[model samples]
Target: MKQPLADAPASDAGRLQVPTAVLPLAFGVLGLVVAGAALALWVIPAVPRLTIIGDELVGLSYIVAGTIAWLRRPSNRIGPAITGAGITWFIGDFVFVPNAVITALAYALMWLPNLFAAFILLSYPTGRFFSPAARALFLTAVAVSAAQYAVRLFVLDATGDYGCTCRNPFAVLPNVALYDVVMLVTRIVVVLITLVTLVLIVQRWRHASPAGRRQLAPVLFAGAVGLAAFAADITAYNLTKASADAGALGVASVTGTLLVLARTAVPLGLLFGLVRTRLDRALVAQLIVQLGQAPSPERVDEVLAATLHDQTLRVIYWSPAARAYLDGRGRLVEPSAGEGRAIRLVERDGSPLAAIDHDAVLTDDPELLTSVTAALALAVDRGRLETMVRAQAEDSRSFPTGRVTLLYSDIEGSTALLDRLGPRYADLLAEQRRILRGITREHGGREIDSRADEFFAVFPMGSTPLAAAVAIQRRLRDHEWPEGATVKVRIGLHTGEPEIGDEGYVGMDVHFVARLGSAGHGGQILVSQAARDANAGELDHDDLPADFPPPRLAK
Candidate 1:
């Protein structure tokens, strides 16, 4: 007993236990019909035993399937309509035992309506071949062919002319040529269409997933049996005379039962496809890798290259020293085509690193970006801490004083330089310190680091503040600069600052010195009024010059 391949609806599985119970019911019907039809076909002239019962049984299938559609797929209008029509017509096939041509014509008319019903069944995509249209067309063709039989039945009844012992009611229809041609053409068309339908069914069957095919298997098998039975019945009908149509009715009945099995396969297969979640793990892992925390450069690169090698993405890093993106060799690099996603990798010490290319979507994932951003932040914080510790040790130093002329030096573009240098900006300030040491020593003074980018110095007690100021300007003007950069220095001086002791942190001497040096400018110097008073002997004014490093700076 082969089962009717049909599946229950999603809601039905949850709401009611009886929804899919029809499958087993259909299987039971199949077993009974198959067994009963088998027996009926063994005996000749036993058409009644097969036709009437088999037609009703096949029609019952439409009812069950239609009822399922009505309950489970209310949105699908055609399925229920076709099912109902099939039910009504198949019921007519049983009740009206019409012997007259007119009655036979009416009987055939009843099946035509079911063809429309079968057409409606096509809309439901369950594993079964729910094509009500084929049935509708088949019924239409059946009716047209029956017209010839009806005419013969009428002629026999009216004239008592049931010609020949082997009387075919259809044999007497006028110039049989037209009818034969029409019938032949219709069969040809139908056969061609069926072939095409078979191809579609096979393709669909093949493409379905393993689970889908399995669930669809019974339905496909049943459908194949039904189609095979139908083909057999037709072949038998064509190969023999109508009076010799001995096994035709029985064969037709068998085909009908098999059809119930075939069409039901669709719904069954669909149900199975839904229940089995295939490749779900693979999908999840792919999504996690795409949206998870980015690993190191190598890992990130692999992900980028592997994930979206087909897409365009390119990233650029900022270079402050060169004022552009720098490559591995510290040279400017250009973008290339087919770059999937671009990510800039910046060197921790303000050097520009390589650009990363990957799939843009991976970069777009907010989670991935946030994780990378957080990691960058931590790296930057650590670098800054290191900078502060080194700056403290390297910038601070000892100095002596006895009315020594105090000088404070600061880089003119320090803030902008820091921003441009990024994490490595702290280290560049060391160069500024070295430059300040040379500048003060040339002017006969000792210098100490006051801060990261600021230097403190003092001339011999009698040296002019103006002289110290001139020295800074001259040093900056003469100092060698890296290509594309100008090293600008600004100094402030106060002559009265005189604190000399081992306590190096802070003092009134350092305080006043700070106030004077705090002033900012590039290649511009400020000398306090006290520094000018101390420089009177060295200046040209009879009483005292108002400038230190008097004439040289004034010039």
Candidate 2:
């Protein structure tokens, strides 16, 4: 059996239960203290008032929003990424310290939070990034940042850059010209990275389905704006002839204030996207109302597609009797979802109930997926019952009452033939059944029941059963059997008013006919006196023996 995606945690019945919010809460408190220290020690004393306030707000926003997201859905890694970004953002403020070693170290690693930003955007919705180009680009950014840090620490002096009055203790051989050249190249590369990031976000949006687009929209909008603003602000500040004035050092200029404001949108957008699952929960509420009681499978499918905003969705019901998943029309269907599709299994009482095939976007929001699936449980079970009923009705044979002729037939030496043919027995059995059914249908006979190599059919009245029996025997003799094996069938005919039951003909007449068929030799037809009397002289036209053996009924 193919295992369900949701069954992962439930597999270990004895696993210890862990509270989801414990770590987030603990880490959130710790992050608050760190952010406070950063603001009090470095930001407030050194930077302009507006920049100090912006730093506090932006850091707090990241931590609070990330904590909430983590509490809401612990499975998504995006939450942790956001929270860690906040902590690292504060940590990077060590660049404002007056100590040479600490400030140099901070300057070397200040791009940590920005790297986190890139990761959060590229891997939006799902925390795990999948695209090869995206992964490569992120790694490239890391490599470039590491190189820049090495160059800044050993090859260049930054005694006055970003208003840092402290001397660079790690500058081994300061070269002003080389520093300018390196800075220029680094700026160009940063611009290129920004452009690539924008292109990637646009590509993702364009390729996404409608449902996927909804999930990506808010985050993409905020991320794109933030990247553009950062690129523009950096270019304008660096390329222009603005002097590195000591008085203006660590001050929040108008452009710096705008940049910080733009940065604030990133966390807000992430928080908005995370909380947006409430809208899906609302849809689930409506879904429950729309479902009501005893809704059809098609209705369940429609409501799910509408609620989830995934139009290409289908529900396949599980039939316990059939031991398979079946469609609304009771046709067998595989649980597999084809290209660009995904399957979510639905279970009742820990047993497989049904599966939903829909667009892959639904997997991004685990909370919504779980909610919608839980809402659909009762409806899917009802649909399963309906599908089973349909299958039973289709398999059942309609029986005729009153006086009727019943014919029973079976392959002679079936066990021995099966042993001889091995796998080829299936082909022989299929051909035999085909011939028997065709002859019975041609002579106005309806099949009452059939199991394996044995067949039981009912005819309306005189001569039809005999005619069908003769035709069956003749076809078996003339047709070439499979596996180069000779095949023969034994037939018995009886006429009586056999009682009809829910499962077709019952009572002694039915039993007698079955037993009589078993007693005959291959290629031979046995008839009872009752049938012979009812259809007198029918054997003459059938080309059967005039002196037929008495019906040998064996119990």
Which candidate has the highest TM-score of all? 2
Model 2 lDDT, full chain set: 0.74
Q: lDDT of each prediction vs. the true structure? A: 0.46, 0.74
Per-residue alpha-carbon lDDT of model 1 for 409-473, expressed as tens digits? 77778788777666656445644454455445545666554566777766766445575466446
Residue 429 deviation, candidate 1, in Å? 36
Q: How many backbone clashes does candidate 1 have?
A: 29
Of candidate 2, the 10-residue stretch with the lowest lDDT total is: 243-252
- TM-score, each model? 0.32, 0.65
Report the poorest 10 consecutive residues by lDDT, candidate 1: 156-165
Name the lDDT value of residue 67 in candidate 2: 88
- The residue pairs in collision within model 2 are none
Badly placed stretches (over 4 Å) of model 1 are: 1-47, 88-96, 99-102, 110-122, 126-175, 208-221, 241-555
